[model samples]
Target: MQQYRNKLLGKGCCGTSYTQVTEELQELIFNHVNREHDRVNEHRGSETNPEELQELIFNHVKKDISQSEENRGNLRMTSGSRALEKHKLPSFKNLIDLIIDDTVFNNNFLQMMGGMTSLQSIEIFSSDISVNNTLFDQGICKMLHLQHLEIWANGLMGTLPWCLANLTSLQVLDISYNDFMGNISLSPLKMLTSVQELRLSDNHFHILVSLEPFFNHSKLKNFYGPLPIQPHMSLKELDISINSFHGHIPTEFGAYLPMLQTLNISRNALNGSIPSLFGDMKSLVFLDLSNNLLTRGIPEYLATDCTLLQFLVLSNNSLQGQIFLTNFNLKNFLYLQLDGNHFLRKMPDSLSNYSLEGLYISDDHLVGTLPRWLGNKSCLIDIIMSKSHLEGPIPLGFCQLESLEVLDFSENNIIGSLPSCFPPSSIKQVHLSKNKLQGQLSDGLSNISSLTTLDIGYNHFESNIPDWIDMLSNLTCLILSNNDFQGEMSIRLRKLSQLRLIDLSHNKLFGHIPPCLNITIVTTAFDFVFDSHLVRIIPLREEESVEFTTKTISYSYRGRLLAYMYGIDLSNNKLVGVIPYQIGNLVGIHSLNLSHNNLTRPIPLTFSNLKQIESLDLSYNNLNRKIHSQLVEL
Candidate 1:
C-alpha cells in the first residue's frame, strides 16, 4: 500500500495506470468525508439547502485527477518543478458574480469556465484584455442571466453585440468611456423597457435621434447623451452638454416631461432665441444652457413660470436685449450668474428686490447708473458688476446695506464720488478704480474698522490727504494713484500695522521721505510718487546760496528681508535733503520708481543693498554729482 501511495498521487490515475487503495485507508477517507458533510448539512436546513456544497466536495476529489493530468501536460511541455504547474481548471464553480478590476488575466483558468451558467454579473475593468474579436466571441454572450453589464476596456470596438439587448431586466446601462466607433442606434434597447438610468457621456455617439419611444417608460428618470429632436416622455433629469446639436430648442419640449427638474444643454451649437414655452414647466428647478450661440433676449415667460428655480446660469452666449422681468418671481433663487453676454441697457430693477446671496453680472454691455435699490437688498453679500458700461455716481443709499461685503464695480464708466455715507463697517473690499470720481475723499472712511481694501485709483479726487485716513488700522491695500492730492507726506501712515499696498503715485506730496516707512511689509504693487508741485521748493546750501532746480527730489524705500512689507515709491517730490543711508535697510524691495524728482548730490551708494530690487528708475533728477558706480550696479 505504501508503494502504491506514490503511484496514486502521481500521474495517470484516471488513464493508463490505476493504483488501487487499501480497504482500511479507503474506509477511513470515506468516514471523514461523510462526517464533514453531515456537520455542514446540520447547520443548513433541508428545505433551502445549498446544493453547491455537495458538488464542491465531489469537485475537490475531481481536482486530484485534473491536477495529475495537468502535471502530465507540464512534463510533456518541459522539465520543471511539479508544484509549479499551471492551474488548468478552478474547482469553485458556484460563483454568481466575479469582478477583476485593474488586474491581469490568465487564459488557462478562464477557458475552463464553460460550464458556469449562474454568472449574473461579470465586470472586467482596466485589465490587459486583448483587442481582438475572438476575446468577446468566446463565452460572454452565453451568460444569458447577465443583467448589469459594465465593461471599461480599450478592446471593445465596432458595433456592440446584438445579444446584449436581450437583457430585458437591465435597469441601468452605462457603455461610455470606450473606443466603440459607429453610429449608435437605440433600436436594440427597445426591448430593455425596464431601464431607468442611461449614461452615455464622453462617447463618440453623434447625430440627433428622436427619443420619443423612451418617453413612455414609467421608470425612466435620467437620460444623458445627445439631445433628441423629440422630447423624452417621462424623464426627470436630462444632460446633453458638450454635443454638436444645433437649431432652436423645441417650444413644447417641456410638455412631454412634466416630471423633469434639471435640464443641461450647455456647450452646443444651438441657435435661435430661448423658447417662451419653457414657462410651462412648473416643476423645473435647474436650467443651464450656457456656452452656446443662442441669441435674442432671454425668454420673459420663463421668469414667470419657473417660480421654484434655485439656480439659473446662462453665461458665455450672444444673448442681447435689456433684462426685464415683467412677472419674475425669483424669491427662492440662491445663485444667479448671467455674465459674459451682450446684454444692453441697464440691469432689471426687479433683480434688486430678490433675496440673492451671490449675483454675478459682469462683462456685459449694460449701460446705466447702478440702481439705488441694490443697497436695499439686505441679504446680498457678494455683488460683482465689473467690466460693464455703468455710468453716474454710486447710489448714496448703498450706505444702508449693512450686510454688503464684497462690492466690485471696477472697469466701468462710473463717475462721481463714492457715497460719503457708504457703510464701511461691513465692506471688506471696495473696488471703485478706473472711474471719473472727483472731490475730496471722505474723512469718515477711516472710521470703518472692518475695511481692508480701498481702491479709488484713476480718479479726479483733489484735496489734502485726510488726517483720519491713518485711523483705518485694518486697511491692507490703499490705492489712490493718478489723482490730484496735495499735501505734506503723512507720517501717520506708518501706524497702519496691516498695510500691504500703498500706491500714491502721480500726486502732489512734499517733504522728506519717512525713514520709518516699512516698504517690505506691503504685498501689492506699490507705486508712490511725490507731488510735482514740490519741485518748486528750492534748497539752500551752508553758504546761504539759493540753488534753483526744476527736478523733484525722489527716494525709493525697500523693506527688510524678514518683514512681510512691499516696496515704496516717493519719487517726483521737492525733497532736497541728503539721501538717507538708512533707506538701504529695505532688502525686500522689488521696484523703486524715483523718476522726475529734484534730488541733490550723487545717488546713494547704500541703494546697492536692495538685492530684491527688480527695477530702479531714478531718471530726470536734480543730482549734481555723477551716478555712483555701486548704485548703477543695482
Candidate 2:
C-alpha cells in the first residue's frame, strides 16, 4: 500500500521491496502511523511541538489504513486490478487531505486515487462498496481541485451526481446517510456558490431545490436536507426536521436568516401559526417546533423578538391562547417548553419574567390561580405544570426557589399546604400526585436533604408516618398514597438507603409493617457501571409521569422505566401484625401490597424469594393458616 505509506513517512523504502508488504500490512502501517502520532500529540497547542507537527497533519489524513482483519480475508474489493497489479499503489501527488473510511472502494480503488490533483480534502466512506453507481463520475467527482467532500454512510445509490457541478471550488458538501434517490436538481448545485457545509441528509430525494438557489450562496452555513429549503442568509444551523414539510413558518424566516442560530422544524407536517416572524430572530438560539400541526397562541413576538432566546420548544402542538407573561422578554430563557397545548388561563403572573431553567407547561388545559408570582423564581430548575387545572396555595414564595429541582404538580387542582417555606437544599422531585392537597407532614420536610421523589399521592394527607421521614437520605420515591395517615409505621423506615418506592396506601396506619421494609434499593450487576449515577438518580422523565398503584389501577411509570420500579404499598392500612419476614427481603420487589391489613398471615415462607413478584396483594388479611405453600408458586 504505497510502499507501506512511504515507509510510514520517513519516506525511505522508496524503490520498494521491504519484503513487499504483508506483515499484516506492515503492522497496519505502523499502527496507523503511531495512532496518528498519538492523535496529533493529543491536541497539541502547548505552543506547538506535536512531534514537530506530526509529519504535517499526520501525512495529511488517511484513516483506518488498510482496514485490517487480516487484509479482509485475502484482499477482496473484487480483488480485480489483477490483485492491485502486484502492489505499489499509493501516489496521490502530495496529499492535501484524504480520508478513506470503513474502506473498500473499487474500480481498482478508484484508479488508485485518480492521481489526486493535489487533492484538497476528499472523504470516501464505503459501506461494503455495493459498487456500480457509475463509479462517482470516474472516481471522486473528477477532483477539480476539490475542497472538502464527505461521502458518508456510503451505500450511495443513483442520481445526485451531475458531476457535482464541476466542484466549483466546493466548500464542504457532505453527502449524508446516502442511498440518494432521484431529481435533486438545483441546476447541479448552481455553480457551487462556495457551498458552506451543505449536508444532504438521509437521502431519498425528489427535491427540485429552489430556495432561490440557496439565495445565491455567499457561504451557506450548515444546511441539511433538500426539503423545504429557505436556508442561506449565511445560515447558521437550520435543520429541516423529519420532512414532508407542510405550510407556515416561512414569513421570510425572521426577515432572512440573519445568522439564525439553530432552528429545527421538528417532525413535520407543519400547519400554520407560530410565526410572529419567529419574534424577529435576533440571532435566535435554538427554537424547535416540536411535533407539528401548530395553531395560534404563543406570539408576543416570541417573548418580544427572541432576544438571544435559549431553547424554546413548542411541544406537541395544537397551541391555543394565553401565555401572556406580559408579552415576554425571556431574559435569556433556558428551556421553556409549552407542552401539548390548548392553553387558556393560569400560569402568568408575568411568570416572574424569566430566570428560568427548564419550565414545561404540561398538558395545557390551564385554568386560573397558580400565580403567587411563583415565589420569585430564583433561577427555577424544572417546574413541569402537570395536567394543568391549577388551583390554590403552594406559594410561600416557594421559599424563593433556591435552585429548585423538579416539582411537578400532577393532575392539578392543587389545594393548600406544602410550602411551609421549603428550599431545603435543592429539592429533588416532589410530584404532587392527583392534587387536592390537604395538610400535615411538614416539619419543614425534615430539611429536604436532596430528596429523591416525594409524591403526595391521592391527596388529603393527615399526619404521622413522619419521623421526619427518616431524614430522606436520598429517598427513592415515598408516595403518601390515598392519605388520611394515622400513626406508627416508622422503624425510622430503615433510614431509607436509597429506597425504591414505598407507598403508604389508604392510610390510617396502625403498627407493625416496617420490618426494615426490606431495605430496598438493589440494581447491581454493577448497575451498568453506574451509568452516570443511574442517569442522575433516575432522571429521564420523558414528558413526566409517576403514579404506580398496583392492582387498584394507576400504572404510569414514565421514563427510564422509572428506574426499574421496585415497589411496596401497604394497602388499605390499619395494619396489624405478622406478614413481615423482612417482607421476603424485598428481593427487588415489583409490587407487593399487604391488602386491607389486619394482617395475620402464616404467609412468609420468605414469600419464596419473590423473584421480582409482579403484584401480590394478600387480600383482606387476617389469614388463618394454609396458603404458604411457598405462597403457592406465587
What lDDT would each prediction earn against the true structure? 0.60, 0.67
Error of 1 at 483 (Å): 1.3
TM-score, candidate 1, is 0.57
The residue ranges of model 1 lying beyond 4 angstroms of the native Cα positions read: 1-230, 233-253, 256-258, 264-269, 411-415, 467-476, 495-501, 519-592, 599-616, 622-634
lDDT of 1 at 610: 85
At residue 631, what lDDT does model 1 achieve?
A: 69
Per-residue alpha-carbon lDDT of model 2 for 1-634, expressed as tens digits? 4454445545543222111222222211111232223221121112321111111121212233334433322221121112222234344355555655444444655655555666777665543454544456666667788888877766787777677788889898877667777765544765688888787766777753446756777787887775543545667876666667777766666766667787777777878887677676788888888889989888777787778977878788898878765767766877778878798877676656667677888888888778776677677788888888888877788877888888887888988777666644687888888888787867777888887888888889797877778888888888888889898888888888788778888879898876766445653311422221131121223434578878778888865566777788888888887876877866778788888888884887887888878888888888765775666887
Give me candidate 2's TM-score against the actual structure: 0.34
Per-residue lDDT of model 1, residues 1-634, tens digit only: 3344334335333222111223322200111111112111111112211213111111011112222444323311111211213534333345454444443333433443334556565555554444324434454555566665556543455666666556676676655555555555554555567788765544566564767556556677887666766756567778777667888888777676566788788878888888887777777888888888888887877887778877787887888887665568866776676778998878777776677776777789988888878877777777778789888888877777778777878779888776677654687777777788889887657678888777777789888778887788787667776788888767777677676556677788767666666544533334443322232121110000111111234222222221233445555555555556665766666556666566667767778888777666667776755766776667
Task: Please give me the total number of clashing residue pairs in predicted model 1.
Answer: 21
Question: Each candidate's TM vs. the true structure?
Answer: 0.57, 0.34
Highest lDDT: give the candidate number: 2
